[model samples]
Target: MFYFSICFMFFIILFLMSFFLFILSIIFLMMDMVYFFEWELVSLNSSSIVMTFLFDWISLLFMSFVLLISSVVIYYSKEYMSEDFNINRFIMLVLMFVFSMMLLIISPNLISILLGWDGLGLVSYCLVIYFQNVKSYNAGMLTALSNRIGDIALLLAIAWMLNYGSWNYIFYLEISKNHMEMMIIGGLVMLAAMTKSAQIPFSAWLPAAMAAPTPVSALVHSSTLVTAGVYLLIRFNFLLVDSILGKILLLISGLTMFMAGLGANYEFDLKKIIALSTLSQLGLMMSILSMGFLKLALFHLLTHALFKALLFMCAGSIIHNMKNNQDIRLMGNLVTQMPLTSSCFNLANLALCGMPFLAGFYSKDLILEIVMLSYMNLFSFFLYFFSTGLTVCYSFRLIYYTLSGNYMGSSFHLMSDESWVMLSGKFVLLFMSIIGGSLLSWMIFPISTMICLPFYLKMLTLMVCIVGGVMGYTISLVSLMYFNKTLNLYKMSFFLGLMWFMPLISTVGILNPFLFLGNFVFKSFDQGWSEYFGGQVLYKNLKFNSLMMQMFQFNNLKIYLMSLVLWLIILISLLMI
Candidate 1:
């Protein structure tokens, strides 16, 4: 517990240092200076494994933001986990996660990046299971194995990089752009990113990971684990530009966004709802990156990190006051009972919905405008706008259920915003969520965006927001009526509620066949054929040989005499011939 305080101080210092470095990096970017440092640790014939670090606006700025969020999370956890006996373990795991994120950010070599990537997967599993419960254990396994798929993909990528005789993939991005090996590596990298970012088939784990502690949820879902994929794509954007694989990524990301948005609408758990929103935002980032808008994706990634982390913290505070109850249906009128938390939550929700000039507005608006400006297929355009509307719909539904609806829980339960430490973290993030987008857009995108679109297309985002918000509110008002009327589309509702059966696909679809095959092999080989041929047959043969030897030994005289007579007869016959 004492060490927890030390960990908090350490992160605070790290945040300050990273913030200072971010300013310097911005100056360097402005001056058109690229800073790279490399040291060759081992060299072979035409091959070298080098330790490399890259300092650019992207890495530095992202690192700074990561450290900022981490510091706040640590401080917030001090209060959130105050009553827990294993606070030290929790804080340490978070610090380790932060270190891995920093390593992933700085490394230019794929081999080196794996150290950080695997570290994140490992530490996140630890954090997810911090509560030591059945639910947390299962969630941890799902999270770990899902991320293991990405780790394997990265390993495949590293193996393929051997063809270039170098592990520093950054140097080969342009040279191997047209090469088959690079294409294979690019596809594998995208798959790896998909798993890490919870895209499509890998999407179920993100929402399930809400079984973790809220601070861990904030860190893992907001920036550290999930966004690692987006950061990887941003670094590899040079190689992905105009590639066929990029288009595939665009399609997958669009689907992921839509799936998550729909799932969030069906979800009742407050934390899970926020988790789904993070998934949706991650999809948005990946889609934008796939379209070659690296800067825009990065901008959204940072701003989303700010608001999403803040959002999770606010959710944590509310959950804490509500005695660990997270069902949105059980909560209501929190705006009056817990004014500070409700305000922060509402503000973060608005930011998430891309309202006006909030942090989400700048990046999401730019992304939509860019999508409209570009020549895209109708599917991509429809997915982009539809997912956008879904985001608003879910956000409004969540707000209505948790903040404004009549309080449905027991009145004896005490709810208040008394934890200053928790509120302190939210306050810091609240300020950022409000202004972080405009500030980052200014710093990251110095030039004004050139947009020329029809009037309806330009107002598409606003219109969707309005329509979605109205629908969300209206549906919430009459939700009981619909619930009582018991429709025949229960299967459809179940499918949407379970994230389009992605979890089933990932778990049952993947494991059932293999489990069945394993059972078959075990029964046939271990119990039947292998038992007959290997153990039973060998035992029978050995027993028969032993019986023959025993008979020969017991009846030795008669057997010997007969053998001699036969030998004599055979000898006489040979001599006559």
Candidate 2:
């Protein structure tokens, strides 16, 4: 009873906090209306400390997703986390993540922005190891280490900028003019964003991060932390919109989406599959972000929060009832027994697969459309098509396998549907996923049309969405017939090979050479030091000199000083040129 009351009290506090923060967000959103509402450029004095929420309607929309996901994760935790784990500590870390993210959303200065950015990374590291086991500990360390490399790159970029004597963001309003510095800052910042967002070379940490609870996986990976990198880049669009590096980012993002989607389809571990899917979705957002589709990125971020969270939480519910079995192959025909859980999972998957009327359909299609509209080149169009096809292949892999596979697990009674709290949390997201299209088309675009890019520019983006969805769905169903081989090499062979190679290459390329050379140098120095001064003989000789000096030190200091002056002049004159 006491514990239950504590849980209740915790949520009450969260409710109040989020409500307060939301009100503040609204105020900040309106504070710079002239600058944000009008297309014309505006500047404030450097001395002015007024906060300016600079991101367009898109950023505000993403912030809404962050709040919704955070709230749901907190509510879901009551049932998700075991009592043995410190629930209060987890809750505290989660709140900190939310608070920091909100700060990142509204911060006007680079320093404040970095504070929020670093805070989220730290909180995520803590949450990753909330289980406090050896494996989780190692995973958390690696994630932190990888992100640290990106953080350092970001710091170097900031340092480069600050050296130019501009602390206000107004300086970057004309980023293209300073192409050299912009290239350096933009490249380094993109590297940081890629690492945080888990793009290639840094993508492996995400799958390992599933050591965290399902709720954390769902919340952090799907909606908030992973999407942060994309959010950061979008916020800085003025600098990147026409840069050479921006084009490279677009290409890399498309490849990442395709590769991650392929990886997700091949994965068998339930959490890991979802983890890869999270990466794939993040890649999709990044690809659009690279093309300057801020609205599409924000929309995808929002819809992804709903469906992906629902999918993960539902997976947790399945794992919870199945004694924590994580391999999807071990269980089947879950829909027959766990109807409510199955239904929710299916609905979420439908949204994920971009079925008509679902939230993902609109947001993801919008992104593709934007990319196509923004880039008329054949390379851009082909990349979008290929990535879209891959997205379909993976989304249906989950749908077909989970729903249509044979029932094989032991007969176990289903837990009741998610608690009223969890259900209500998802209910809000589900509603958003459904109505988000009309909202975007009718309201958000119209409002931001004046200040942002025009509405007619979005037409190509909308057309691509509709066309891509149909093509992707049709291709996936047809491709399944020819892909009946049971090798599953992508997971068993390729994934394992990549996993093994990371540490293996790190050791050979970095650690081994350093260890071998360092050991040889240390041994040589130790032997030389021993020969010269390591024994009692050396100590006795030093003692004898000290005794003689004490006994017969008649103006020795004067003689030494004379010799030192002579040596100094000879050394100075030799090098004077």
Candidate 3:
């Protein structure tokens, strides 16, 4: 009861704070007001260390959304973590995560951003390993180390920024595009963002992080861990949009989107599928931002946060009711038992597919339309539309597996919709998922986006969604006959299902050489040359000298008399000379 009260208190406080922040953000947006507060900690010759806070609409709105999601996730945790012995610890970790996210959101200074960035990496590692199993430990290490790459990148960026004599990166955005040092700083920042966002090469950690508890999954996937990179890039768009690095980011992020979408279609794990979808969306945000649609990327980022958080919460409810089994193949016709959760789940799934006027439609459709309008290569165009179709295919496949067919799990488990506390936590996000897009569209950019395109081009998004849905439903209906037919394609399926061997490359393939080299170093240096020359050999020399000295110390009058005669002869020879 005491722990429950603490959870409730946090939820209430965050809810109130978010509410206030939202209102303030709206006012700030309407008035075009940006307030900057600076506290100088040190003022040295030609260098000042200061803590700076930027209260523009972007930071305020983002902070509000993050706090809102964190509060709800905390509320949901009360029910989900009710049986855990250390619920308070979980709450504290979550609170720490929120604080770090807020810090990242508000800072315009590179040094301060690194502070928050490091905070995020540290706290998320704690959350990932909260379960304390081998899988969790591996996942936590992967997540931490992957983010550490970005942390190092940010550190390098900060160090590079020192050449500018101040760490406030905002003042240098326009200047960054022209200078070589500024360009390097931008690249470093982009590298950090890519790692944090789990873009290619670093993609292994996002799904592996599913080893964490569902509540942490909700928080991490939604607003904190993965999005941190996108948010940072959003801040650094000025430096990237006009540079070659921007084009490279677009290509990489587009590939990431396509890879994630294809992998999700092949995935069986429920949490992993959702995590992949988040990855794909992140790619969309990055790709779009690289194409110079900053507002669209930010729009998608905010909307994605709402729906993804809701989706994870719904997944948690289902997982809890189904005895924590996350295999989608083992779940079917869950709507019959868990109506509310199923409704929210289905809502999120459709939103992800960009169906009609749901939260995702406004932003996702606009993004696709803008991509169509952009002058880009056919390869990039194919990646955009094909990835969209793949998203719907996987979403529908998930729906058919979990919500359409007869119940597939054991008959003994009683999946119920009685997790009211969890449901209550979900309601805010559910409502937001329905209207958050339009609401943000109205609030952020009052001036509407204008588009003039051919009818066929305009309808491409809907066409892809429809076809993808059909493919999803059709292919998911696998009978024994279907199984036999696909048996010949086992190798292909395995390749696609393995995320094109990305996880293998990231883990075993990348680490094997380093590990082998470490072993060689251990043998050749620490244990071989080092052990002999500086260790064993030196010890043997010291021991031999000590033994010789001890022998001289023994009672031996003959040896002492010989030594005295030699010394006296030396003295007489010196006097005669």
RMSD each, Å: 5.0, 8.3, 3.5
Q: What RMSD value applies to candidate 3? A: 3.5
Q: How accurate is candidate 2 locally (lDDT)?
A: 0.69
What lDDT would each prediction earn against the true structure? 0.89, 0.69, 0.90
* TM-score against native, each model: 0.89, 0.76, 0.92
- How far out, in Å, is residue 400 in model 2? 2.4
Ranked candidates (lDDT, high to low): 3, 1, 2
Ranking by TM-score: 3, 1, 2
- Candidate with more favorable, higher TM-score: 2 or 3: 3
| Residue 190 displacement in candidate 2 (angstroms) | 1.0
Please state the error at residue 296 of candidate 2 in Å. 2.3
Q: Per-residue CA lDDT of candidate 2, range 140-216, in tens?
A: 87678768878888788778777566544545646454567767877888898988898876776777788887878
Go through the candidates in order and give the clash count of each.
0, 2, 0
Cα RMSD for candidate 1? 5.0
lDDT of 2 at 298: 68
Give the 10-residue window scoring lowest on summed lDDT in candidate 1.
480-489
C-alpha lDDT (0 to 100) for residue 29 of candidate 2: 51
